[model samples]
Target: MEFRGLGFVPLFIALWCTAWVVVSYTLTVIYGHAPLLMYISQTGNYYPENITFKIGFLGMSNATLVLMLLQYNFILLHAEAFGARQPMIQRILLAMGITSCIGTAVMSVFETDFYPVTHRVGAFCAFACGCVYNLWQAILLYEVPGIRRAICHIRMVSSAMAFIGVITFIGCRVSVYTKLCTEDYEKIIEIISISTEWLMLLLILIQLVTCFQPMQHLSLTVSRKGYTICKRENQDSAV
Candidate 1:
């Protein structure tokens, strides 16, 4: 069956990843302003500095908005799929997803150079909440009928990778902040930290792809009251 609304997930992933790649490359290679191992936020630190900074800022902001819309779609898909019989776990997942989306927006808006504290808080919320959401989602999917076992396995693996990435990223970041390593060691630690951050982000986006199958049979409609998601009838039959 043709999936409706699956485009949102891919669009979110593509926009963010492209932004990161283009901005990071421009700063490190073309502009020679930032180191290769600099944090993602560093690429967009001074928005007035260059066009790449503006692109990074705008890209992340737009991606966060798309992420929020994707979360809403997931909530509606769950509501229609399970109806009133939906479990509390589903509600909790929806809440976590929304919280992560909010965190993403905050992080995108508050650059680390200008708003260090707020940016850190937003990053903490986005990564921590998002990691928990992925693990919990994997567990919940096991209980859901008709979901493929392979998808559940993939989710579980992706969640574990994200969890590991978070821990490694935190450890390396803390080591750098504390000056626990020598000057030479600091660069290595920084590289590891940045790499893990990228890994965590990519895994989070990958996990969202698992939802595409579940959403294949669903479609959204809007009426005078509000928006509603409904299962699509077989197109062949309608024809």
Candidate 2:
């Protein structure tokens, strides 16, 4: 499947997560230098400034792993929505999960450029994903006539999470630009980072909420199957 359009979902998630890591590292390095790092200089001290860069890059790598996990769940959710029946979806999701995990492991071993410009590819990918998912949900709501009635709850939740993603992207970009304004622009960046982090976190929480409800429904359905199987077994024994 050409993820040309769906590519952004993973991309943006990476960007938001990376930004969180970088900003946090920046705060830590600056704070470590002096109580006044927050007041005077945005880049902190010069000699050991590379430490923040290393720390931020490490944070980015960790966040990417978390993003990959979510992507696995997303692929499963995609397969389920497309009607893979139980067994097929399970196998497909497992394969995709394993592949993504392995790919991430390979990437983790390398040390490469961590500049924002280089990282913007991830940001662009994230924007693309967010937009595509929004469109997909809209299509699901309007075009897919079969499950419209049944999926009202799903649509509502998906719409809310998608909206948050859009808002988070805009907020993060603005904060990044603001950080470039002056020497001591770090404080404002820190504030903005905290806000965006919470926003992205809210998205994570929403995903968790969606994940559990479906599993709950699936468990109930499986229990019904178990009951039927047991009943048939007892009847055969009686016969």
Q: Quick one: best TM-score, which candidate? A: 1
RMSD of each: 4.4, 12.3
Per-candidate TM-score against the hidden true structure: 0.75, 0.36
* Model 1 lDDT on a 0 to 1 scale: 0.66
* lDDT by candidate, in order shown: 0.66, 0.41
Backbone clash total, candidate 2: 5
Provide the lDDT at 37 for model 1: 62
After aligning candidate 1 to the native by TM-score, how far in Å is the CA of 144 from where it should be? 2.6
Q: Which stretches of candidate 1 lie over 4 Å from their true place?
A: 1-16, 48-86, 181-184, 235-239
Q: What lDDT score is found at residue 117 in candidate 2?
A: 45
List, residue by residue over 68-87, the lDDT tens digit for candidate 1.
45544555455545547455
Question: Which 10-residue window in model 2 sums to the lowest lDDT?
Answer: 227-236
Error of 1 at 176 (Å): 2.7
Clashing residue pairs in candidate 2, if any? 8-125, 8-129, 9-129, 11-126, 12-126
